[model samples]
Target: MKKQQFVCTSMIPYPSGNLHMGHIRNYTINDVICRKMGIKMFMGWDSFGLPAENFSISKKKTPKLCVKKNIKSMKKQFVDMGYDIVWNKEINTCNRNFYKITQFIFCKLYKCKYIYRGKCISYWDKKDKTTLSKEQIIKGRGWRSGSKVVKRFTKSYFVNLKNSFLKSIIKDIKLSNWPETIKKKQINWIGEEKGYVIKEYHLFFNNIKPFNSLVFSFNNLVLIKKLTKVKKQLNNIISNKNIFYKRNDFIYFVGYKIVYKKKLPVFISDNINFKEFYHPFVLNPFSNIRFKRKMKRKILLNLMFEKGFNTNEIFFKRKTTYKILDWNISRQRYWGTPIPTIVCKNCGVYQERLKNLPVNIKKVKLNNNSDIIKVEKTVINCHKCNCLSYRETDTLDTFFDSSWYFLHYFCKDIRKSKPLDIYIGGEEHSILHLLYSRIIIKILNKIKIVNFKNPFNTLIIQGVILNYSYYYFKNGVKNWIRKINKPKKEIKIYKKLTKMSKSKKNGINPYKYIKRFGVDTLRMYILFIAPINKNFIWNENKIIGCYRFINKVLEFFRNKKNYYYHHHLKYNKFIIKKIEEDINLCYKNFKFNILVSKIMTEFKILKKHNIKNNNVLEKFLNNLYPICPFLVKSINNNFKCQL
Candidate 1:
């Protein structure tokens, strides 16, 4: 038996009709790195999503059919892009076999008491009847359905991320190779905010001792208008920034403390009050008008109680809520994995029997107009009793599918599976996907399902792809162009480099680019144009240089002959060493542009001198094989040389 050398994967693509520039950039980098590692990357699909389901409904096809078609087309494009992908090992989340494993894992976690049914705050789209992530809710509306977002507490399956895993993640995340900004975002999201809530007065304080003035977000306009200012800046503390930024602030009593002593501090507060308290304002004590003195929590509580301020007795309670609360794993859509649980009125909710795993909704019909699943509101009977029960129709969040997909590359048995050598993805996933995966891994380790706490040894975050958007003014109206080239000069045109979007209509159709310039040129030019981890504008003109370089390499291979050589000349070693250095630099800092630029420059020098050394040719071709495999294959076919 032989051990695997390295196991690496890029993020599994969503299998949308055509690959975007961002996909090209990510896959190209992954392909080159895998080639250098002498390992083949596995292509997988994140098949269950809203777009595919919606597309299926619009096309009058089943979701599975639509996904299969998209997957077929995308696989062809992936092969056309020259990626060394393992097609046989491919996994789809919507597949019965794969999601059976997903359901198994869900139940195993439930058995281990890692999952529980809880009420989670979610943004629900009434029209779609689906729960949306925070990002999916744009300006109090659903991004896709254009329905007014209604925030409500929904009963759903959730995992506790704030347990032992919280401490471990914060401690170990520092050792990761993630960017500082990304690390900061993760840390900030998993906030270590500790506070105490005195329900008697609706006051939330950060410190248990309350030595620092506690700032609760007060919404009482009459109270706010009546109070004297603690600081001049405190006058505007009731502004919209408090609501927008989720800032929790304290009240500084001044003008009429005697008149409204009971009503002042006992106002009921909502969830917005539990956030970390900012002590930007001073507190006023009944004894001290200056309000500069500090007192411990016990003293303050006793004084308030004795002074008869609102409450008959002091109620002191410590906070158990965390910033990462109610880690919801449920969605109300048809395209996701059904939550593998059951609810019974007589008995408590429990995992479905292993034999009854993966309550797949593929057979479930969809409403013609609403697009929501049309099925029996009630499902399986309670496993314990023959009592009336219902199956949990809410689907697992797509993140649950992605969090453990990497493990399926080897086998679902985490005890036998090894962590990935490297995993590359975009920075946009730095928050939810990255955090959730790590949390899932930690839970696996905690429950003794897996021996490891982390999923990968190294993680690479890819940058967003950017391009200059061209807009032409037609009859004094700005209209964006969908193609790469500028419009005819008869009309006025403007160009600006920005993020790509369909609404902007500045999207570059990769199929057209590949058809015109060849996929090899597009792959090479993407690597050559800029660093993989930094956003750079797409310049169609810069691709011409890479195109000509590929042509020159092919021409050099065709014009010359291959022969066995005992040793390379001294100058040849220098060029090969420089190539090795650049390759190392690429792996180190993600500077593929520098690597490609260095290779092209050296090849130009070799061409001018008419060098025919096998060492130089082999070195150049081997290095370039990752970036432009089709071009190298053409050369290999002509000369019958082993790359």
Candidate 2:
């Protein structure tokens, strides 16, 4: 019988850098699921981006060189864990073949009129002298050199995703085999609440001071120091970059605040001909951000209501307009897919054509000086008009390559695209990367470039692994501390868990951990620490507990009586049913933590009767394969007494 083919992809990490514990957790979950399902899996590098370029600048190296080195390191890390990876399908987005394929998709959209050029606000890294995405801009600092990013704007291309397109694609997403929570988030994010006034404010601070009427949005009793202060707040409300760029004499904002004498429960907003002033209630602003401070808190909460902050339950946020701004995909530093537009002497600027999709770009290296990096100087012919054009020096957003990357695996050469069976990545990407990829896929399909409207039939967002660091800050003198040796008080410093990274100094190299404790221990610990979609704090005690559990499993198998059964009987049947239910639930709800617990429980229950029970052991071990393949293999061998 021919084996069924299933396409599985890991949104490749930028090979321009090191793998953190979070990466290990993501890849491990993907590997486990694929192995359990016995499907063909693909892994590759999102190699063409900022990290590589940043490395080149700092080390006086080429992006190609830096990315290759990082890939080598990552590959070793993946292989060291005995992952069954399809190296053949491995690709680098930076490579000509892959990038050309991406450009092909871009060209298809551009031709179909779904792609539009627009100016959008972006986080400007003055130190790097480049544009950075929200992800690239770390929470409080620049992702590159820890410099604070300022608000800036740039000319960029956006896939003209329409409401019809978003609704059509997102409406039936629940029908697909994906996590319910994830699907819910996607649907909410593709929010389209119609029925609000389309008010286009012209920053009317000078002349229209108080509107010569009682300030309505705010309560009279909670009046500020003056009405001008209310104007100041309204002006400040536009400070959010997402709100500011969408403002103009034209292009009315998606929604507007509703004034009600009582709890009328209606909201409305629009930028075009669609006109209405009433709609079904969504979420109360008061409930959404009940955890606000003083002053702007109530206003922010009310705005939330106008923006569709549904307070039905804690499971998800309310739906408002799909108000997310277009991506600001330009970066100044070297080492990325060169943004495929060129400035021309006659026509100003235009995207190069499909045939010359990835225009040959000159390479430049970054010196230690952040501002003194060498810029590429070369001219490439524009595919649009065959006019002599200067190449676009700005590189494509790294997220461009990362977004919809899973689609590339379905069609390895995206230039001749295919469909993806499934996509797996960290839950952290659910909003930014996942949403962006969905939008890109929809635009590509709308433009007739791709057959599928959505990229992934199934998306499994693995949970993040937290490297819980115990910092010892005694008498204002901070010192590095390990989890195993730290005092209980010192360990308590980690108030809440977070994703591990270099700046956090909380990440542990998985290989070193795997070597210290066997592969089985490492895998088991990850599974047991948290549910498949929740974050887990990494503690050495947890690893030790996993190691201990493995030893117990081995000891039980070794000492148990050898018994075989042709078929499961009453109690056995019950056990089998429970195991099946657990597996199904684990996949369905993504409850990997509970899944591991069930495995342990079953093993302990059957320990006395399972020495030569190969059938029971096989079924049990196979279920465990996703979590700890090495342990499963070892158990299978020991039960058969072959190794």
Candidate 3:
């Protein structure tokens, strides 16, 4: 008979930096599942994108070097945690094979007419001279360089995902096994607004030659047509920009629909006579804007409800756009994978090919590549096209590296294969990264590059490692603070406002916690103190309680003189029934607290009676092997209880 087969995968983290406690929690839970379930589990690295490149640029190191260092550190941490990871399938997106496939998929999408070129208006860093994604754009003058960013537009490429093909999958896919919060978030990210809003506007055209050059900014920049005949009437009402104006002589009304990214525009009629040119569609609660034209580049993106339109209207009905913004995959940063493209002088256009990608490091000179070309990393125009267009140098979005990493594992063992199994990660990625991964999978599958119909059969999004900052005021000014002085704060104790990260210095390191307290103590304390997803403060005193509990169990085992019938016989069946019920509940909930509680209750009952049945005790110990493996193994090895 064939052995049972099971496939499991962990969402690879970008080697951004050191792994945090939250990351440890994510991997630890997965490791436990893999070990207990007795299945094949795989691990890989998202060793590509911005974090690696950014670190390399900052440290003046190569991205390959940075990733190597980070991977070494992360691997050591995982080993220490006792994770059974299949490291042979480890992947790095920076590799030619990985990105070669990514670019090939891009070509396939392009061939299918799902790819197009357009403009992206945003802050252009004069020093670094690149467009910044929303995350990379700081609230200062410039995120990378100190120079102020200016509003500049660039011609770029985009994948056209606004179709029923992608939309239908989302509508049809059952999220029953997934977390409800994540499902709701993914639904929101898809931005589906059910009913359509319709509006009609009357204006004379320059020559009535059927104007078709109209484009709308879903992020709120509207383009009005410049008509020759209606120029004066339009000029009196509408500015050179898309802003609105009202006149006493004549009245103008505008109408449009707020459509989801994947849906066609129906109609959303909002009649404004003389108000500002801003449409109600632009400002929404979730919407934020960073004006490329602003001098200081304030993150003035938050909606205040007083802007131009009602927050309800904007959020309830989002602007729908069939036109896609260009993929601004260019950056002038010091360190990043060079966009593989060359410009042709005769044709004055750019060309990119997959086979020639991931420029040979040894063949080209880095200094010369940096000095003459202004933009350090770049794509090239096709040498065959003879065009003067420069290559787009911006690297792929770092999120792109992590998005389909789980899929890669399925095919990692094969010479050239596809993804296997499911994606397991924190709840945080559901919005941007996970959504994009779904789109990427669909596009890849549609192109017939991979055989798999769905990227991941199952998705398990774990919760954050619930923790709280421990601080105490000194000098009577409420300023000076220390972590050790405070008591443990449970997630139920205090509501925190910020996420824990290295930059915040908000969490205690597990290494320090373990060194001070035993591993079992820390483990027991963490689970008993709070629910898995909520935050709690780390306190040594609480950990001491766990240590005491373990000591109590050990003492009970060691002190017994005889194991025959010294304890009570009446409650054996009743206690066993209760323990079994708790185990069933634990199987259903997968909750640590409930399992621990049941174990503790059983221990208390066993201790109340003299050491009675060894067989009963052995069964109890085996049941706890999932949570506290080390202690159970230690007891079995030393005592050798006869069942």
Candidate 4:
């Protein structure tokens, strides 16, 4: 019989140098599962993007140097914990070889027209003179500079996900073993709208041919000619993201009647602007194509609004659609995957040739963004015009780097990789990160980069780690208390037990707990405290209980006197069979807390039975390895703990 093989994956840490409780809980869960299941696991670094750049700036050093230092510290911490994961097969996002693959995928998508240039509203920090991500904004102000964030219009790249593809995502995600809440988040973000709202007068709509693209009561051809001359008067009325159906807010335009079939181009106003349109098309919410006749352009604008325009009644039907916007993947930051694009004055936007895969990013000072060049080459010429062209300085949003990162692990045979057996990460990624990865994987499948569809078969979202931070308001500004000496009641009003974050100054170092108690005790305590998915506190008082349990287990393994030269073959089978059943049930239900409780109970039963068999000992030790590896390591090393 062929042996079943399993591979486990964990979310790569951002390599920010500060490994806090959140990282410990997440990686500990991953390590425990890998060890318990006998699955081979791989480690990688999510080394690109903002956090490292921010840290480097604060320390007055370069980003590459800072990231290199952090990776060394973090790897040692992982080694100290004895993860037994494959460190040699590690991949880093910022590495040239790794990002080469990332750029290749982007260029491929760009060639296929899945990627395009579009305009988006970006948040500009006036004080810092930089772009701030949605996360970097605290309320309406920049978190770093405390500058009020204002929207700036900029041309950017977008991965054009047609509406049809989005609906498929809505249907296909049900196959994965993800939390229902996470699934709902992706669906809601896509913003699928079902059926349509039409009015009674809209029934003038039987056969709709809506080719006209102008504000009419005016002739279609004449309106077009007149609009060229009248553009200045209608400058503010151009369609943008803000245009929606409300009389004052609406800038009426004739858009295609979006239907399942190629319905005729009908008169579709985007919900309320007939006051200036001079037509009573707003007589219903969404009208059926019914225009009486054409009037001259001069008379149409002068028509009185008091003459017409009234909604008779509402209408409804069962329909399906998606309102999802294309993905915006442009960032103004330096530490990210450089967008593999160039623009020329004559030829417009051009994708870099695939043979020249990575348009290498030249690292520069944090404040300086001008004259970003490709590798050592100072000037790159456009393929079409052969004239001096500019490289796209805007690096991709960091999320793009992570989108297909897991696939890089199996890049040699992405198709054979099937789907990642298990993927583990925090619930905070349920929206942006998970959705982007899933969609990018689908795009890969569409482009035949990967044969399999789903990126991960099982997704485990760990709950947030909550902790208390004492703080008080000072002159209308909130300040976190560095030293806590006051009584609980005195600080009660100011004490906040929120998710452990560096911003909140509540994140505790895991090594502190690891030093007091061993690594095994720390890992066991986290699982023993509550279910892995539950949001719980990092309470220090409960550490002693786990510490004592580890010491007891360590003593049993070391004492040779506890072993006997007796063989109870039949009794050993009975004990092993029962233990296997319990372990299976625990894993099946993800009841890790119960496994530790049951192990404690089983020790009493083992002492009572006095069963002395190596097979029984091996069975118990193997199952217990996840919770107490230090004790089990001796048995594994010294021939399976002889009875």
Candidate 5:
């Protein structure tokens, strides 16, 4: 009988630098699962991204060189940790052969009418000179450059997401065995708003369009004619009612009036100094705020219709508008998958033929002034018209590189088969990467490229490792201050335990821990810290505890003279049963911490009982192999014991 097929995968990390504690935790969890289940595992680098480009620019080297150096270092680290990954199946998104598949998928999507070009407003960072995704923008600023982001309209390619498609995605999400928190986040990200769009008399105030203008009620017309004098009058009227304080910047109004053959109260309020309103005024009929005496828009529309008013001219039903926008796959940077499209003056825009795929990134020297558009090799002859044309200089977004990587892992020969059985990634990508991957798989399924709709049967979003981040304020600007050993009274240093990241300089390098305590000890320490899904603070003392446990196990196994055979053993039976129960529990709920604790307890019990049965000892070693493979291998090799 054929062995059951099981494939496990994880998010390919960007080769920005060395792996950190978070990377260790994520990969270790998946490695342990795959080993315990006896499944196939594939590992690769998400090597193409802005971080690599920035590093290349800073080092005055090509992105290829930078990526090669970083991947070598990172791969060594993974090997040192004894990850049970199939080295032969490694993939790098930056590789021409691998990206050929990505570009091929892009052409498929284009042919399916899921891809289009349009002018879109994007967050542009002037300092970095690149468009930033919503995820890359932090609190209205660029994440990398810390520059203020401004809106700019640019011609770009987008992946169209229809309302029906979104509903289908959401529907499929409910059927999957994903975390409730992640499901809810995807729902919110694809925000669906339902309401009617009623037309209002614009009154031609401040050049506002009069006909077909959206309004919540007819009373909004009164504010249109405001000469700035009407605002003061409304403010005074509200203040006289003792509803608002005089010192307040503005007062709220609930004025009722008749306009355009309808009598309804139009909710108006001052825009200045009002924390509640995001705009100058809140005018949506479906707004959360409700006036005590105001009638609903639906009721007012019915009354106007009864009065023989032309409903089409005065009001219309609202169309569903989704909050989630189409994905902008265009990026103005090097060190990414080049978009596989060519623009010809005679033939218009045309996707490169599959035979000419990959649109391999040309090797170009790096400089502070490097621009993809200025690169000479970017210009290419059109595949359709055979005329001089330019290749799409902009590279595909990094998210595109990751969106379908799991599927590629299962498609070694591009066969139609089920997707991977398990996927492990960070919760930070719950909305962006996970959602995009699911959508891409569905599209591929519709196009008959794949047999499955979902890529992974199960997804595990690992919790982030966090450390205490220290920073100081300098000249009214917050500066990241590292290496704070002791608090200084005059400096007013601030610190908070947050997610480990390179920008904050709070990430703990896994190499340090690996070198100091050995990979097995570091791995056990991370697994033993807390539950896999919860955040825990980094502590050196706990690492030492793990080191001691490993040494104790080593010492216990080395003394072969102390061993004795116990034929009838009640304690060994109990220990074996307990280990089985812990293994089951770990597989059931991903409670690796609990499993590690139980294993330690079992070791202590074995020592206390002085159990010397070889069969029992081998059973224990097999159970421990997944978590501490290197240590177990060393012990077995030295003692000629089978694990």
Candidate 6:
């Protein structure tokens, strides 16, 4: 029988700069998995993103050039680390041919009515003058610019998720082998809340007309200053008792009071974090109360009855609405796949013909003033009307490029019919990239572009690598201080272990570690440091320990005569059985940390018995090969033994 096909992939890293310890840890975990499983792996770069654009702008180079340079450097590091990747199957999103396929997929989505143009509220970064996806927003600020992000109604293309597609996606999540934590996060993100859609009526206060509104109880009422007309009317009704406040850091509490048969108060406080009601004036029923859903429903029903509404007249049936918004894949950036669309005044929006695709981005010089859409070279005649039309200026979001890349690994012909067997990525992408990819795959399956409904059969989310970060506050400004740099004069210093990030200046360079210790030693040290799915704190002393362990292993092999033991020894069978059991368990659960510990235990047993059986030693070396390939290869060559 043919061997079962297996494919593995990791989240492609953006070529913004050097590969850090975080990148090393992510790739190494996947590498070990693929090696142990005896499967070929495909790797690539997420070459098109805001970071590459920012880096290019700072360095006075084109984004393409910057990405190319960084990928070259990073690929060398991967090679040096002995990653068993199929370079021929490798893909870079920045490649025109690759993005051409991306554009083709977009066109397919467009034709299927999955893509549409609409105005929606999205996170807008004023400094970058671009729109950000919910995933791109960090703490209500732009991830790249660190500028405060604000809600803006922008006209852009959106993927339609308000349909049975969502139900299908949710259903597939239940059937997949994804981690329960990630599955729960995606379910929460989909935010399918079942609530009643009650009929609402307007009530007048102080001769002011109240529009369609809902009623709920509130202690205090406040109005946003932006609603000048409403504020003025409210001021007259309350006799200037209304408190007004302006805050950029917190949500504004715009409250209102209405009378339906009886007076009812509604407040929109920041503390009310539940989904907004359908009516403009509403209150969170769960806020300020620790009641169960059934109790809350009873209280709401009682309130409706008190408002002179019969039980039959009140609409109490449950309805569902997703908190997750439709994906907005339009970006006003230079270093991304150009959205393959054209707009003509005489004609409507049209997708570029497949034959004319790629719509090469290299032709346009991505400077501050150069707009590719308006350029004469990019303008084309409408296929039907022959009227001149400009290409879409907005490039596709980087997430769009990533969503279907795993499929490309197996579907090289695009007409072929296979999905990736496994996909490994960071937990942070659970809701964003993972969800988007699933949606895209479902759409593709519907359109008969591929056979698979889900892209990956198995998913692995590796934990983040964190390092100790030190900061000092001076004159109300917090400065990131290096650990080596001691504060002077008894200044209060704070230290915390946070995710290794370039912006925080807390990232450890893997190259530096590799230079001090060999690449195999560094790889082994990282895998041994923590469980694959748990956050690990980087420790320098651990690096020294790993280096010492490598040296000890080399010394043992060199002095094998003194440590040799016969194969019939009683302890030999125990050591072999223990190693076999541990290795099997490690491969089954991807518990690399436990595997390393078990291997160390076996090493202790070996030294105690002085085991010198070539067969048993070869089995031990073979198991270790996946973790430290270079070290194992060297040992096999020097010892003249086949492992």
Q: Write the per-residue lDDT of candidate 6 for residues 165-195, one digit (tens) a residue.
A: 7777889988988899989988888866444
Candidate order by TM-score, decreasing, is 6, 5, 1, 4, 2, 3
User: Per-model C-alpha lDDT, please?
Assistant: 0.68, 0.59, 0.51, 0.66, 0.71, 0.71
Residue runs of model 3 more than 4 Å from their true location after superposition: 1-5, 122-151, 173-176, 194-392, 413-422, 451-454, 465-497, 535-541, 557-571, 610-615, 640-643
Residue 618 Cα positional deviation in candidate 5, in Å, after optimal superposition: 1.7
Q: How many residue pairs clash in each candidate?
A: 4, 8, 40, 5, 2, 1
**Deviation (Å) of 287 in candidate 2:** 29
Candidate 6 at 127: error in angstroms? 2.4
Q: In candidate 1, what are the lDDT values of residues 1-643, reduced to their tens digit? A: 2345578788897866777787888888989888877888887999886767777888777789889998998888888888888777899999988888889888988888778776545668876777776645665676655567666657777675544567778877887766787788888777655555565444444443322223323223233333324422333544644422232333342321221232232211223333343432112221111111242345544433445343224475665333545466777877888787788888978888898766777475556775655556565657799888988778888888898888888765656777788889888777778888888888888788889877778888777777667777665445677655566677666778766655356656788788888988898888877677778876777778777877878778777755545444445556657767877777566678888877787787677766667766777788788788888888888787777
Candidate 3 local Cα displacement, residue 113, angstroms: 3.4
Alpha-carbon lDDT of model 6? 0.71
TM-scores for all candidates: the values are 0.80, 0.71, 0.68, 0.76, 0.81, 0.83
Question: Best TM-score goes to which candidate?
Answer: 6
Question: Which tens-of-lDDT digit does each residue in 7-39 have in candidate 2?
Answer: 766777766456767777777777777776777
TM-score, cand. 6 vs. native: 0.83
Model 4, span 364-440: residue lDDT tens: 55444432222322367888889998888778877788888887666444444467788888887876779889889
The predicted structure with the larger TM-score, 4 or 6, is: 6
Mark the regions of model 4 whose C-alpha exceeds 4 Å error after superposition: 1-5, 123-149, 195-320, 365-379, 412-417, 470-494, 560-564, 567-579, 608-610, 635-643
Per residue, candidate 3 scores C-alpha lDDT tens digits across 126-168 of 6555665433455435533444555555654555655365356
lDDT of 5 by residue, 1-643 (tens): 2334678778888886677888889899988888788765678888887777777777878889889999898888888788877877788988888899889889999988898766645678876678877656776688776667776767778888877888788888889888888888888877765534443421111111222222232222223233122344444554455423333332333344344454533333322122232222123332221121254444544433334334445545444545566777888887789888888789988788888776888877555665332355467767776788998878888888888876666555454567777788888888788888888888888888887788778888788888988877665555665765533557877888888877677888887888789999988888889888888888877799989999999888998644545444456576567677877777667788988887888888778877788887887787788889888988888887776
Off by over 4 Å in 5: 1-4, 197-315, 368-377, 383-387, 413-417, 472-481, 484-494, 561-566, 569-572
Candidate 1 has what TM-score? 0.80
Model 6 segments more than 4 A misplaced:
1-4, 198-228, 231-261, 266-317, 362-377, 470-496, 561-572
RMSD of each: 7.7, 10.8, 10.9, 9.0, 7.8, 7.5
